[model samples]
Target chain A: MTHPPLRSEAAELHLSHQPAPEDLERPGRRQLSPADAALMEQKVRKVEVAISLVLRVGVLVSVLVIAVGLGLMFAHHRAYLPLQGDFSYRQLTSGTTPFPHSMASLARALARGDGRGVVVLGVLVLILTPVLRVAVGVVSFLYEHDLPMALVTLYVLAVLVGSFLLAGV
Target chain B: MTPIDFVVSLALVSVAAGVLGSLVGLGGGVVIVPVLTLLYHVDIRLAIGASIVSVIATSSGAAAAYVRERMTNLRAGMFLEVATTTGAVSGAYLTTVLPTQALFVLFGVVLAYSSFATFRRRHTDQPLTVSNDRIANYFDLHGSYYDPAEKREISYKVVGTRPGLALMYVAGLVSALLGIGSGALKVPAMDSAMHLPMKVSSATSNFMIGVTAAASAGVYFIRGQIDPIIAAPVAAGVLLGATFGARILGRVASTTVRLVFVVVLVVISLEMLQKGIFP
Candidate 1:
């Protein structure tokens, strides 16, 4: 549970004459020379930068997916017309006919003016978003060597599962 | 309920909700529910169900940016979620079984409380406390952020862990019963109690409220309360609105924004109280 004490040049200058905690450790902690400490900080910074880059990419991908999905939905809805297709306008409008229960039902509902289809699609997007968000979070935790947050992500999934089961939404 | 009519309405509502919800930081549920029930004459239960879906959309859209910036404390959010989800389930069940008048009364009271809380003075400059959590250290929960105002990297530890988490449980319960996003309470608990920075706490609260809503939304869905006709516009509106809000977050003076939010909350609270007392 011990962590390496974080030190910056300013902090180091303030303690130039004083011994570090590592100097007072029981087993005589291995002291990193100033050069080594600087190297370590550089490595941490590199890792941080790399992690940030990956997260940025992830955000972009998520946004793209959502945008495409919404676009397709809009296009399809606008193209749908009554009397041109076999399905009557009545069938399209009255969402309660319980049309074949499948993706077709969703599609038909959307065509028929059942706004619920849009909602279902919206929910799908919502679900995907958290997955992407947690993925990015996972990468960040990995870079930070934060196993607890990583584990907590798994726990979040469990909460998701429990919520699904208990709320049955 | 015709398909063509439904599609057009759904699209329009979705777009509106998305734009407005994004602007206000609410998933647009607050606005959507009233619109559906009062304007469209949809049932309240159905409107709530639709509103729930929109909450999910708003959170999902916004959570990623927050996560990437490391503004969301994943551990704190997940830990508090256990309480929220459980409470949400109970609240959902209560919503189904409670008398309409009683539910309205409770909802009104909660809305009023939330409105008052929103306008209250917020303490944002509190120093962070060191956490004694072995797991926190093992996981490197402590971190530093660049404070633009201070022009320094401020490092901090997560603290008041137990109390903060306990509060989330209550937050979840309220979220479920009321069907309102619980960010108002969750943000304060994390920032004021757990000692997270204001921005981080707000982002984390946003991340957590979705799961809370999902827990209850599922229940409503199963009960056949989720009329997609109603849900479609609500979700679409919220998603659009939340995204817009995220973009503008950094552009405005936060204090002014907060004051406006408080004023809105007060107005909404009074409306709810009037509805309950009169109805």
Candidate 2:
């Protein structure tokens, strides 16, 4: 069955029509009005370039974040290795023994001097990542005139607030 | 086993569990609990605590990308969370008071049922539309996404809002009590009952599970169940696996993934039953 082309008359929307197979094989052939063809070509090129940039940036950022988080964790683990005592996993689970004087133990001991700050930092990081993600989504929605996404962002903000109050965070 | 040996062994098991769980989409708790109880002989309560923390780590890592993509229904997630949070707190309390063996048997049954549900074929021929719901209308709970396969925009509404939210409460409670990530229940409630598309339901479920885990994780931390050595490896492994899984989700074949998930759950359920009855 042949399907009709989708058209919206609610607004004068410019959409690029797909080239027929015959036209596609013949590289320079054009079957559209000059103005329409020019507009389509321009719009297509712009979107292609924009999408390429977005993908590149996204990959770069993801790699950088993963690398940094891994680096920090590894460095901390290495520093603690030397101080570790004859601590065995069995003793840890049994709960009758104290942890050996390892670097992790030292870090925990130091943190105990200022445990509140570490907890607060952990909570802040937890809260901020989601907020940043939602902010980016909201901006994208506003650009696209997508009210639903904006509303979702607002709802998330509300939830965060409610959770904070309820949990007394 | 000594404390050091226990921590090291638990870490190794957690890493294996995380890798397997990510592959199957059930999360690591299913694997962790059995490994701890049957292999390492850790108390069930302590196993539950460690599993919950790992759940939070996995969910948090996965949710970041979903939120960025605008696929996660943040409103739907939060609104449903009101019910889930309440359920989680209640469930945590109940876990402390209830009989442990009974809870384990009940959890195994739920896992078996969920595994079957996941294997069922999905119906995607239905058009997206809003059902009559005052709450949904008031909240403007409607969204559309571009379906690449259909090459069209599909709009959908939030239906059966109240029932779906109520179900999430139960899901949360069960998750806390059983130490299983509740995504299995949350995804179905949103997808089938609330009329959300499957992809959106999955992403939103991923986002919400972290919050539920965190509520209980805090309590576990206070109770000193979070041994740093055990928690560190579990958290790191789960975070890595979840992030990898989320990245591949859009490219994977849906049916194949679901089938794998079902098989894994069936195995886990049988293991749980065997341990409960024999041990």
Candidate 3:
């Protein structure tokens, strides 16, 4: 029923992947089902390409935002330290933490065009690149009809979101 | 040093680290932490947070090209994520309870072992001589990619699926515990245990690290370790270098890559081992 997963399909699919379903469906289409699977495979390939683009764009966007922030920081203070070092970890036992109270506060600061906020937003985009990739992966697997893989990727995504939300609590 | 001067210097250093790390299939975070904490006198935990973000950046930048070339084993990567994600969550907690120095030494030993595993150089064109692997068969884990340099398609069959998955769990735990070791372990596991081709292993490793690092980066952010000024330029530099590295991965010889990996692994392992022993 599964058609042996591409070993057999490779010969036919690789030969002609351009023909649409309508072109191949002209009555008595012997290879219609395999063609459909091949089409599905091609669609899955698009998802991979999309994932690649998302990662590339996300990183560049983050870099741009961070660069702008650095510029602003230097414009404000061209001295010993352009920005505050409050986020730096002192030690485990020091207990005097300077981390922002929540993600919302960080976002608010970013909206206010604070230099540090812009910088953090860049890092935020960097972190989200992987999360976005995993999200696309779920769609990729489902398109391939590979339910198990979809479930696995979905679970990984869940772990990421859950850990972020529950880390402080 | 002025803060602007410090960030500039750190970003410059990170660019080279990113290039070398990405070229050898180890993301830049491995070296970033050492440079920050030891050379610049940054807090170890703060260096860790910055490096984690850099790992995601490097992985993301490299994965774009690697995955597009069809070298990454998507299904295999997904299957292993189940193990990695679970291991990562547990390892995050382990950080609070365990003696981290001893764990670092242990992971350093593992790195040494991995270096030895990949020390040999083999021709990349040689076909994977595997057969009758039941799990890989059902999952269709085998893949093929066109080698522009070799002027042919390189087909390979993935064996040791279960071992690969189990090793990923260890890699994830070690990564969470150590902050950059996970990405380095992936290629070795794929190359030795799974008998995957070197190029495929590295590319898949690139594809997988972002997800693994993301699992922990979140915790680092919430804990107040990810400093924007520190993390930003470092991430940008690493991402830039990794993007360049990914484009050339298809052209570079596997033998050369393996030899370079062995050298980097030995140096990093010795450094980590030394730190653990002295600290």
Best candidate per lDDT, number?
A: 3
Q: Estimate each model's TM-score.
A: 0.67, 0.64, 0.85
TM-score of 2: 0.64
Instruction: Give lDDT tens digits, candidate 2, residues A14-89.
Output: 1111112322222343455999758754543443244324433433343344334334434544433333555335
lDDT of each: 0.55, 0.55, 0.74
By DockQ: ranked, best first: 3, 1, 2
Residue lDDT tens for model 1, B218-266 = 5665555565434444554555556566555434443544555555456
DockQ of 3: 0.25
Worst 10 residues of 3 chain B by lDDT: B123-132
Q: What is the lDDT of residue B149 in candidate 1?
A: 41
Residue B252's lDDT within candidate 1 is 46
Q: Give the lDDT of residue A119 in candidate 1.
A: 47
Cα displacement (angstroms), candidate 2, residue B99, comes to 4.3
Q: Which pairs of residues collide in model 3?
A: A80-B3
lDDT of model number 2: 0.55
Model 3, docking class: acceptable
Per-residue alpha-carbon lDDT of model 1 for A49-138, expressed as tens digits?
553355345434534443444455456655444524544334432335232223456578667654445545445445444544445555
* Tens digits of lDDT, candidate 3, B1-279: 557667778889878877776777777887888888878777777888888877777788888778888878877887778788787888898888877788778777777767875774354335454434456655567778876567677887666666667778878887888776576778877777667778788778877777888888878887778876678678878888887887777887778777877888898889879879997
Winning model by TM-score: 3
